[model samples]
Target: MSETITSDEGTLIQESRVWQAKGWTARVIKNEEDDGWAVAMYKDGEAEAALIGPWTMGRDKKNPKPLDHNAFNTLVKTASEFVRRHEQQLHASLNKSLMLNADDTDYKICLQIIPDEDDPHAYLSAFNNNGEQIAKIKVRPDFKLNPSSAAKWLEQGFQRLD
Candidate 1:
């Protein structure tokens, strides 16, 4: 059996095929897609891995290279960056803003999507040049906010939306 080390924090396993430290885990597993090895990086408390990639073969060319401090640090950096980019992209998709002019006054219009699994919806809001919210109303999640639509909505006095 492999040695198991523990501290006040959590389990810290440094073995030939698995490593866990610093709130992340890297495991070497047989690649199901080919006759090679793959490494998976998992964030602590997460059921699924955050990143997976090919692993280099060891001297024997039959086993994976043992996880080391340097390799694990690199894996953690790469995985963290990947997760950050994914979150930024998701945020961009969920929230959007645009500017339009109505009645000779400049206004900023924003549409934020609420991705509730049970009752997904969105809110369309208009703010004046002073950044004061002028109007806000519940809109469909798929509401398209373009110059034409926003201008029409403003023309209609931000009334009940369809």
Candidate 2:
């Protein structure tokens, strides 16, 4: 049996096979492919495993090695990096931004894609140096957000592109 831990966000964290850590849980489960064992690392509140790897066999050559603080810490770091990379990739895919200087003023142009099944679209927006919104327009999901494209839109008085 394993002990369950929870986070402050009301998320059911990891099931500690031996030692538990904050915002993380480690579990040793039967491998889905063969009769061997595998270790699973789960982040607090997430419904899916963040990292999964083969469990090392113990010195006895009969069972998996027991979890310890050192092993758990290493798993936490690896799993955290995995989650961070995933988030960065998702952000890059869904949003694009560019900064342009015109009339001695810097403005940030952003395009956010909303991939709704019924109606997919992208919202193009601009903000001044003060972070005040200048204009926002709904455009095609495939709209490109780049320096040249943004400069053209600014030259066109921020009008909707047909």
Candidate 3:
């Protein structure tokens, strides 16, 4: 239901929800000090955001460019493409931490991949049910888990060696 627009200044501004079904929403705020707009994307039921970034600005300084029909259409296309790429990256990261036990409920493991500066790799964190971190793995953006490792984990399950 929400949409994103890229300013002529090469900044990507998003003014829509990430997903209508998830109820995740976002708004673009212009920084007065800097000529940049900050996008805050948050889920409806959560206080924190799912994603945030700076949108590029448009060319021509006389007046802020308006979102006309053509501009709106182009913006939607560009923004959707960005969101799709991000979603794919997230999915690939999660797949690296394959679920061990399909029925066990006592121990739970989840993976979180966060982007970092100075490096293109994503910081992967393995967490336990109590939210305690189990392991941190720095993986390349395009890295994929070996099938053998995934199978081994599935058979052995997770252990709290810590």
Best by TM-score: 1
> Per-residue lDDT for 108 in model 2?
94
Model 2 global lDDT (CA atoms, 0 to 1): 0.84
* Colliding residue pairs in candidate 1: none
What TM-score quantifies how close candidate 3 is to the native fold? 0.34
Candidate with more favorable, higher TM-score: 1 or 2: 1
lDDT of each: 0.90, 0.84, 0.48
Which model, 1 or 2, shows the larger lDDT?
1
Clashing pairs in 2: 14-25
Q: Which ten residues in a row have the lowest lDDT in candidate 3?
A: 14-23
**Candidate closer to the true structure by TM-score (higher is better), 2 or 3:** 2
Q: Write the per-residue lDDT of candidate 1 for residues 1-162, one digit (tens) a residue.
A: 255689766668887788888888899999999989999999999999999999999999887888887998999999999999999999999999999986689999999999999999999999999999999999999999889889888989988677
Model 3, 66-136: lDDT tens per residue? 33344444444555566689889878755555433345533233344445566655444445567676655
For residue 91, model 1's alpha carbon misses the true position, in angstroms, by: 0.8
**Candidate 1 error regions (>4 Å):** 1-8
Candidate 2 per-residue lDDT, tens place, 1-162, comes to 354545564534333354456677788887889867788888867779998999887788767887876888898899899989998999999999989999999999999999999999999999999999999999999998888999999999899877
Give lDDT for model 1: 0.90
